[model samples]
Target chain A: MISILKNWVRGSNKLERFWLLSKIEYKLRYYENKLGLVWALIKPLSEIFIYYIAFEVIMKAGIPHFVSYLFIALVLWNFFVESSLGTIQILATKKYLYEYTNMNKIEIYLSVIGSNLIGLFFNILMFFVYYIFIEKGMYVSWHIIFLIPIVLNLVILSLGFSLILSNLYIIAKDIQQIWLIIIGLGFWISPILYKLDTFRAALPGLEYINPISNIIINARNVVLYNHVPEWGLLFWGLIYSVFFLLIGLYLLNRLGSKAAEKL
Target chain B: MELNKEKVAVIARNISKTFYISEDSYNTVKKRLFNLFNTPKPKEVAALKMMNFQIDRGECFGLIGRNGSGKSTLARVLAGVYPTDTGYVKINGSTMLMNLGVGMSHELTARENIYVSGSVLGLKIKEIDKVFDKIVDFAELREFIDTKIKFFSSGMIARLGFSIAVNAGAEIMFLDEILTVGDIKFQEKAIKVFEKSWIDGKTVILVSHSMDVIKKYCQRVAYLKNGVLEYLGDAETAVNMYIAENK
Candidate 1:
């Protein structure tokens, strides 16, 4: 238990190091693009538009309030997908940095997440502006405050996934190729585009098992429906986040040092 | 935290690293199916074998070896960058500068890289800030402090890297061929900094091919021959032995 506490403290300190590196990442990514950070909102907004047309207009899912639901879900899901996939290549791409510094491997993992969070936060903030003020039709409520905890939970999930993927990619190069396929399959399995109620009756226990489904649904409820998230589901998602994070961190702590040797 | 001045700062015992040289394990599916009926091929390489050493606090030690002689493997093991398969490393206070400018991103400005690189070396931002001017002055890139490091010359990059490293204030420092950077003037400047660090009771383990560097700075030297510790004694004798053997 004491060791766990020590590890927690060490992990928190490593997060600060990640915060520092994320500044570099932000600078490097936007250096060539003249539009600068406006590109963050532009990219996600474009993705939302494409998915909205495909699912709501063309496929004719006939789901109620499809536009608002799609908007909220895509914004939240974008954070998780971008963070996890970006983290897949974190250790592999930063091989020179890890080989040279005394920095913790966990820091490299978290830095990618941190940089993604910056863009994710911008995207989320824009959703509010577009829904509340610009559209001038949707209602805004205090329940939107639920986004804070939900975003935190998403971060925990991404960090956990990053821990496993980064370390595993070192041992098996094929993991990257396999990860893309898994992520694509994961999108279908989760309720990113579809409603949980649509699948809950057919799949029963399976929909609840996917924590991302609960997170996306909760985010949509707060942003679109102006309703508080279901406490039971929220609690389960938090538990899963913690569980995955602990397991991932354990594997990372055990295997991270071997990365340099393997590479 | 006060340190024991006379105690051993780093200890390595029976350290070894083995790596597999995989050859075409992912043959086409049809070919893989056919290979099941044929003899399986074997491919592997052991990078390091049973290396061991210890360094007293404030000692300036040198590591000399030919290319692919496992000097880097030993350095990585000491830095905790690579986990040892068989042994353990007990380090008191170590910071590895394994490769200069490896951590700095090209897009970040000089000021930003200082904080990022400094933290990676285990220095707090406040500590780095205190020495910020000195770091810049040493690098001699004050005119372009706000410019992105990518725009800087290779020499300037090396200067920035070395300056940040020197100011990190680790009790034990490991440098791998960092002196090969910049011009002769800058090299002389770096040598002065190294000498000053030694005088201030810092333990420095320098891994370089420059016989002159090893002979000039190190009080004692160790020769790594094919992942084995060949000799660890006087600096002059070790350099002579290395030169003789390679010739």
Candidate 2:
């Protein structure tokens, strides 16, 4: 713990830099658009609407409180998808930052993920607003606090994939298309628009393999169901995130040395 | 101002760098599958080969070479942008490479660019705020502060880049072809700034094609010929060597 504190103090400068770069990234993303900030909300909202039309109206999943249920999981999942995909080309795109300055390579990944986190926060805020007005009889509970760790888990998981994929992307550009297929399948595999128990029986040990599954499960438990998170699953999810993060950071340090040269 | 010749600021020992240019990159799995038995070997280009040099603290050192002579590569290696293949570079102070429009996002405004590049230089936002006005004033870009740099001329961009390096730069600065851009007036202003206060107690590694700017400021110069240090001594001899080699 003391070491962690020491690292935080030492990293105060990097943290400050990360915050500024992320803000620039988030702003620059919508800089040219007329709607600007509103586009952040529009993306996830539109995704939820389309999924709702397909799952609830047409297919008739008929779970409970479908909108909020899907919104909670979709918001978390979108952050992972967007952040990882956005970062695949980050080392090449943001070469200017590190090529001339003494900026650490990890900071580039942080800024991109941090920008996605901003979008995630905005969508979560919209989720709460929806919960209050649109969804009736759902009481606010302390279980909501669990969303913090769940969100952090999602961020870490996305950062892991970002680090790994971006490093591979420097070597091979085809990781982009391959990752798209993976995430498309991942979207269906997780309980985003479907029931968890149905897939849990079919694909045993999925929560352990797919960290997003555990995160979605925990998020829904805390926000919608008002139940405490499955502690076992939370522990496993944390393990998976950390495991991925360690490997990603390792690959970044090892294979990412030729990043500037390759790009 | 006399520099502190006692303390060493930058040191490079037997460093070399080689780049591999692959004719065919099997980026996709399909390409990899089809070419499973035989893969194309990458062609090697030796950017720098067995080079060694050191600069004292606050020394105005110049690096002169013809195009593709590894001057920029050596500068980058010393600036810690590119790692050497064989040896290491030990820099005693913070370093910044002031290449052409480097670290400046064309899509960002001058204000935003300043903050981004400043932060990368290890300055906190509050710290940048203190030096913000001075940077804009020195660049003579007060009016275009909020405008995106993409709309600005290359000369204006160079001025902004130079100003940022002057104000918010590191202790050890690698200036790569910074004088090539900008108008003659701005170049004169930049030369004046360098002469007046910028070079005081700062280790500057200047890479330039202009012999006049180099001869004026450099106490010593290193002339590189095709990745090898051909000459390292007085500025006049090195400049003459580079010119004669060109002919």
Error of 2 at A9 (Å): 4.1
Model 1 lDDT tens row, B1-247:
3435468878888888887665665423344567677735646557788877788887888989898888877777777777788888777754665466556767678998888777776666667889999999998988999998889988888888888777764567788888776899998988788778654678888899999989888888999787778898999889988999887
Q: Write the per-residue lDDT of candidate 1 for residues A190-234, one digit (tens) a residue.
A: 777776678777678764688788798788788777899988888
Model 1 reproduces a share of the real contacts of 0.49
- Candidate 2: fnat, from 0 to 1? 0.69
Off by over 4 Å in 1: A1-16, A30-32, A55-64, A134-142, A226-228, B1-6, B24-42, B99-102, B210-212, B236-247
Query: Which candidate leads the pack in TM-score?
Result: 2
Clashing pairs in 1: none
Interface RMSD of 2: 1.7
Docking category for candidate 2?
medium
Instruction: Single out the weakest 10-residue window by summed lDDT for candidate 2 chain A.
Output: A8-17
Candidate 1 at residue A90, lDDT?
74
* Model 2 alpha-carbon miss at residue A48, Å: 2.5
